[model samples]
Target: MELILALAIGVLFSSGIWLILRPRSFQVITGFMLLSYAVNLFIFITGKIHINKAPLTLDGVPVDPTRYADPLPQGLVLTAIVIGFATTALYLVVLLGSRGLTGTDHVDGKERDHDE
Candidate 1:
């Protein structure tokens, strides 16, 4: 499962980077979203993979690091996801305004001539 997650993260990161390098505003926004997802996945994985483990210890039980999943990373990822969503919405608004003013969705603010 870890291997699969690692591979998925790698693929997401690479694809995000590739899209970010493209010339379209929409694509760039999508890339940023993908990058955020990859980061969230990375943060989640750092908390360690434990199956059937509780996130908290029962009262009077000995505290064992191995018995409970770390909650910090999960909390952090949740916060990051919220922030990422807000940022993505902001970016979309900006993209729309840019497109309205410039009449093009390209990063350069101008459409590329096919002949060029």
Candidate 2:
């Protein structure tokens, strides 16, 4: 499971990077979203995977810290997700406005000359 997750993270991260290098504004926005997802997954994975375990210790008795999955990463990921969503929405609005004004989705706000 860990291996599969790692591969997925790698693919997402790489794909995001690849798209980020493109000349299209929409692709760049998508790349940012993918990159954010990859980072969130990585941060979550660092906490380790556990099931049927409590996130906090309720008893005063001594307990092993390792037994509980770290909650910090989960919280961080959640916050990041919210922020990413808002930013993506804002980007889309900006993209739409730019597209309307420039009549092109290219990063440079101009159409390519295909004759070359």
Tell me, by TM-score, which candidate is best.
1
User: How much does candidate 1 score in TM-score?
Assistant: 0.89
Encode model 1's per-residue lDDT on 1-116: one tens digit a residue: 99999999999999999999999999999999999999999999899987888887799998988889998899999999999999999999999999999999998888888825
Residue pairs with backbone overlap in model 2: none
Model 2 spans with C-alpha error above 4 angstroms: 58-64, 114-116
Go through the candidates in order and give the C-alpha RMSD of each one to the true structure: 1.7, 2.1
Clash-forming residue pairs, model 1: none
**In order, what lDDT does every prediction score?**
0.94, 0.90
**What global local distance difference test value does model 2 have?**
0.90
State residue 96's C-alpha deviation in candidate 1, in Å: 0.4
Q: TM-score of every model?
A: 0.89, 0.85
- The candidate that wins on lDDT is 1
